[model samples]
Target: MVAFPDPNHAVRIAANELRIAWRTLRGKSTAQLASVGIVVVFGAAFTAAAAYGAYLGGRGLAENPGELSQLVSLVPAGLATITLFMAAYLTVVQLGDIDVRDGYLTTVPARDVVGGLLLSGYVRAAGLFTAPLLVASAAFAVGAGSPLAFPLAALAVLALTATAFLVGFPIGVGIAYLASRSAIVARFKTLIGAAAFLAYFGLIVSGTFDEAIDPILGVAQASPVSWYADLAVLAVVPSASAAKAGVVLAGSVVLGAGGVLASVRLSERRWYTESVEASERETDSVSSGRLDRLVGRRPAWVARKSWLRARRAPIKLVFVAYPAFLLVTPVQASVEAGHVTSSLPPSIALYGAWMTGAAFTLNPLGDEGAVLPVTAISGISGRDFVGGLVVASAVFGVPLTVAVAGGLAVLSPLPPVALACTVVAAAVLPVLAAALAAGVGTTYPKYDATSISRSREVVVPSMWAFGVYTLAFLLTAGIATAVQVPAAAGALANLLGVADAAVHVGALAVGVLLAGILATVSVRIAVRAFDDYTA
Candidate 1:
């Protein structure tokens, strides 16, 4: 029953796939097209700048073959690591173009499908960088005063890219094969992916990524991967050996061919195998619990629904994690020194409160999706619906903010009195922030769904809502922070021509009172808007 792969058919399939991608690009929205244009322009500009820089460096180093040789050797190692890692990463994430998976797999041989998909991916990647890379190679060749260097360097880079992608793609496919068959991987794939990403992110933020890079580079340089350098600079660099160039060129072809064969086999296995199914299931219906009785059943149910959805599709709330990057510099500084700084506490409080509102409270109307009409006319008051969102955000945000901010404040040089105030503000600000966001979200809602994944789509909150809510949070949180920092408070006092004590006590009291007033007004507005919603 096994069918032989037709290379001609695979070529046609890849061409068709590329045509479809081009059509899709042409049909994108104006904003999407503009973003793509911006990226291409930036890429082209960066490429030109890099090529010019390389030309200058190459010309200078032409008289210093020893230095140039060492630099050239190191470049290929780093480049190999990057190319291999990126190719594997792209393959792992995409799992092949999903649109081609169905009809193509059923109609064509698995080998042909895999071949076409790989070709398509290669073409797409090459389309972006091939011209720029060739330009850079030519510049380097001219600067080095070797006419033969241009073709050699281009060959090395192109061969290296092709070989690395071929090798990496199979590794990714192998990983996919394991994931499809493994029950444990199926159950906790998301958590595993998140942990890997977080670990990688932590390394970069801590400026310790070199700890990871050093070993990879050392191993790569010691291996045949370093042979590419010989091919690249064979004519210009005295250290470049003809024998090594021959070995690398020959090895790359063998490896690339073997990788293609392995990929076809692996893809066939993976495509034919039934994927492991997750057994965990949620309850069929939402019911109000004892806590729900105290908080009103309708709002409680709504809150419960929101929590379930968040758990099921955590990507929808990925925006909440964006603020974590803001803490990197301050946290890194604190790590270098001994203790947290005064700045860290306020940053935590402000950004933490911002994260709270952004998590679940924003986009009240849009988040409801197809159920908007049903939910709007379900006889539940706007008070219940809006209250549910506020509760959902505050319950999680308040405790977390208090724990993080209070913990950091305890480690800082802040006085006991100020620490207490900080903790109190941390706990209270998130609640007010949630209410503020709910109000702004309802006033300026967005209902258009944006795709987050192949199968999942979500309606993100409007930029107007984000802008207005950020401004409101900054005002409220800024005043609270200023009151706590003596220098800031003194500045505020001098600006307003008030005494230090009045600035510390009176201003904070007034800020809290104003924040409370605003939160109340915003909540009422949100409730009214939700109640009157026709869509």
Candidate 2:
């Protein structure tokens, strides 16, 4: 017998969910909250300063009303751009909050769950966003010397911000839905999300978004969006037309408010009716023969399976996050200045090595999943399993590091000897990273497949393992950096009272020797751990 779902209780459920999300936010670590608060405060201050500047510029151009039209457009352009970014960020955050923690959602009607979650997320986001917008607008008005313009301008800003955010909500929800259900998208969604986020920051930092407003101003001149700006400007300059404000307010309420409500309603239905899990549509077609011929069958099978799992669900590549961090400088520089510095090569090479360590070696036991007991019983020796992982990491990490380092070396302004050292570090460092990954990760294997975005059953390395690996990687990277960069090498040689050539040689030798020794020791640890595990 099917029980019909009741949605009369949606608001009640949504209220409860909101309370829970509030508590979750409240329960966050002090450092985490402090960091977030600092970012918000900084952003608010910047916005306020910019708003004050715009007001000053507008006031300066008041004598030429025709010229002031471009200034009028800046008001909406600034607010709308910020609002869009905030909306996307909030949407991504909200999408991540979805849970399959329980099947109660199955019985309670999907609409109620979606409605409750959406409403809760929306309210929380609105509360967090509204304060900053209001604060910046109020600061602008005070600086404009028009305290009376505060109420009307603040009201219009709030309305437009809300409308823009609400409109963005559906777009985010749609992307999240596709990610959850489509295997192909689910595989690359993390990369896509990262790209989109970085691109936005890139455009903003480069002042490209500001330049984009010139063409857009033409379209917005007589639009309601422009009137929204007019209403904001009127708050500063009382001489500006108030009739534009009235029409905008009325139109915003009628159209924007209606759209916001309808979007939520439709999103609820769409999310509920269409929700599905992402699952593989095709299985791996890898043959074990080639690997079996190269290594033993057992080790080859394990390696093959590991590669397949990663290929099928690439979100499991959490270790890549370390390498990605190293890219921030180069990416930001390229976006801002249209080029990367010569110094980026060593950093990039070191990061490649770090990725190798952080990759496949972690969570060997946990990664076995339901097959752990069977695989253990089959008695695949610890050395072979660990050895297989090292081989797996080397296959990709080694070439990746060497190729990238060599390529970047061509672009570097380093002395020839330094370039040679860079190439050496790139070659040997990844192998060392792979070796350490096996031992440390085996010692602190993570089995509980925690949620990363929407991908399920994705096992990652334990925090302990990651910390130790990162510490070693950083030390090694520092050494590599010192040896591979001409300035750093010369300084180190002077400080250590050694020839520059000798210092470079010694550093490279030490890095390779250190990595090899650790990898050897780490692989042994992995073997011991693997042998000791009983099903």
Clashes of each: 0, 0
lDDT of 1 by residue, 1-535 (tens): 4343578877888898788778867975565688789999998897898689668756765777763355567777877777677767767666354474778878877888877877876776544565677788899888888788889989998888888878888887888889889999887887987798789778866778899889999898888888898888887778778899999999999998888888888878888889888676665544447647768888888888788778777778876776588778867777677678766786787788888988887898888889989999999899999889888898899999999999998889776666777787788888888888888888888788655543456777777787888888778766776576666766887999987666656655666776777788889989999888875
Pairs in clash, predicted candidate 1: none
Error of 1 at 213 (Å): 2.0
lDDT of 2 by residue, 1-535 (tens): 2222245555766687667656655775454478669977887776677567645554543434342366566666555655655565666645324555256456676545555554555566655556655665665566566676567668877777766666666566655555666767665666776687666555655558567655655554546677776677675554567897888788767765554454455455455565554564454435557777888887776777778777666767854764465566664565565554556677778888888767788677887888888877787788788878877887788899899877877776667777888888888888788888888888887787654433244677767787788887676555765566667778988999988888777888887777677778888888988888875
Among all candidates shown, the one with the greatest lDDT = 1
Per-candidate TM equals 0.90, 0.77
Best by TM-score: 1
Query: Which portions of model 2 show Cα errors greater than 4 Å?
Result: 1-10, 23-75, 85-118, 136-150, 174-223, 233-236, 261-286, 330-341, 365-375, 444-451, 454-459, 494-499
| Predicted candidate 1, C-alpha RMSD | 3.0
In order, candidate lDDTs are 0.78, 0.68
